[model samples]
Target: MLEVRDLVVNYGEAAALRGVDMTVRSGETVSLIGANGAGKSTLVKALMGMQPVTSGSVLLDGEDISRRQASDRPKLGMAIVPEGRRLFKDMSVKDNLRLGLHDAAARRRGADGLDLAYDLFPILRKRSRQLCGTMSGGEQQMVALGRALVSRPRLLILDEPSLGLAPIVVAQVFEVIEAVVAQDVTVLLAEQNMHRALSLSDRGYVLADGSVVLEGTGTELLQSDRVRTAYLGES
Candidate 1:
């Protein structure tokens, strides 16, 4: 469903990605795992068009989207749940979710998508009229996930989903992810928790310094010596 080939991104003279290549097949969950400064985020942002790619290509459903603006990408069925669960602090939970739907009727009435969000996370329905900022970290993350879901994306890209959350909350988030995958949404996951990421993914890619160093089925990669040493710190 998504493919990035030899993508390179530079900040002035400093290079972030040198030649990253990865692909996510339809109806599959793929994880990208790497340490800090490995250019995982850079590769994702390049695909999202938040950061420009100096060279190479990004393909969505077999079409080149390398130069497309971030705003334009969403309407084409690509959505991202960024590392930080960014939310409008003062907005009501329902209103925050309403911002995600692009349909004029749904965005105007907010009834259709709001119901869907409520179904995904019943907590959001209960907190519909409450300020988003006052919610707990887990609640906020739920809201972020709901917002992305309401848009009905074909390719869902998640970055560092477990960051700054308790283990229980992180597990809950992963559960929600499995639910999303069950609905046939393709996932591209970048996560620091190598174990969790690899466990959930159908396939895995190891990123090092902005390039893909290894790729294999999740179980295969998990048992590999290189993955153990580089990411899992296991013997």
Candidate 2:
């Protein structure tokens, strides 16, 4: 459903991505796994057009969208839940979800956006009128995912939803992800936690030094010696 070819991204004199190539199929959860500074986020930023692509192409449904503006991505059925759960802290939970639906056309197609989002995170429904900043970390992450879902995106790009949460909460978030995939929304997951990510994804790509070092089915990577030491921390 999405294709990124030889994507290169730079920040002034520094290169964040170098000739990176990746793809995510419809109904598949593809993961980009790497340590910090590996350029996984840079690849995402470039795809969303938040970061400029020095050279390469990003395609959505066979159409080149490498140069499109970030603001246009949401209308094209693409949305990202950034790493930090960047919610409008002072705003009510309902308003945060409303921000996800950017286009009038998309909004008109659905009156149940809030209902569906709340259903995805029952906790959000219970706390819909509360200030986002006052919620616990897990609750805040739920709000983030709920907000993203309100957009009715065909492809949801989530950057580290499990960051800084308890293991149980992380598992809960992944359960939501698995359920979302069942609803047929394609997912691109960028995660630092290799085991959690690989378990959830059908396929994955490992990046190092701003380039793709490996790509394989999740099970394959999990069992490989290279990934075991470098990522999985196994013997």
Candidate 3:
């Protein structure tokens, strides 16, 4: 459903991503796993059109969208739960989620979209009117996930969804992700939690220093000596 070819991105003279390539097939979950500075976020930003691609092509269903504006991405069946759960802290949960409907088609189904989000995380329904900043970290993360899911995107990108939550909360989040996968939404997960991410993904990519170092099925990656040593800390 999504393809990235020879992608490159730079900040001034420093290259943040260099000649990277990736693909996400429709109706499957794919993981991009790496360390803190391994350019995972850079790749996410590049895919979402948030960071300028120095040179590369981003294709969605064979259409080149590399130069498309970020504002237009949501309309192109793309949505992201960005790293850090970037939310409108001062806004009500419902209002914050409303921001995800950036196009007329999504807005037309806004009511149904919201219903689905609330159904996925029932706590959100009870806290719909609460200010996002007053919510706990786990609750706030729920809002972030809801905001993205409310758009009913075909391709969902989750960047560091487990960053600051407690272990139990992280498990809940991944359970929700599992449910999402069951719904046939293609997912591209950029996470540092290697085990959880790879375990849930159908395919996985290991990024290091702005390039893909390993690509394989999820179980294959989890059993790899290199992945165990580098990310899983099994060595």
Best by lDDT: 3
- TM-score of model 3 vs. true structure: 0.96
Among these predictions, the greatest TM-score belongs to 3
Q: Which is the winner by TM-score between candidate 1 and candidate 2? A: 2
TM-score of each: 0.93, 0.95, 0.96
Return the number of clashes found in candidate 1: 0
The segments of candidate 3 whose C-alpha lies over 4 angstroms from its true place after superposition are 109-111
Model 2 residue 189 lDDT?
Answer: 94
Clashes of each: 0, 0, 0
Candidate 2: segments with Cα more than 4 A from true spot? none
Backbone clashes in model 2, listed as residue pairs: none
Global lDDT of model 2: 0.86
Question: What's the lDDT for all of these models?
Answer: 0.85, 0.86, 0.91
Q: Give the per-residue Cα lDDT of candidate 1 at 225.
A: 96
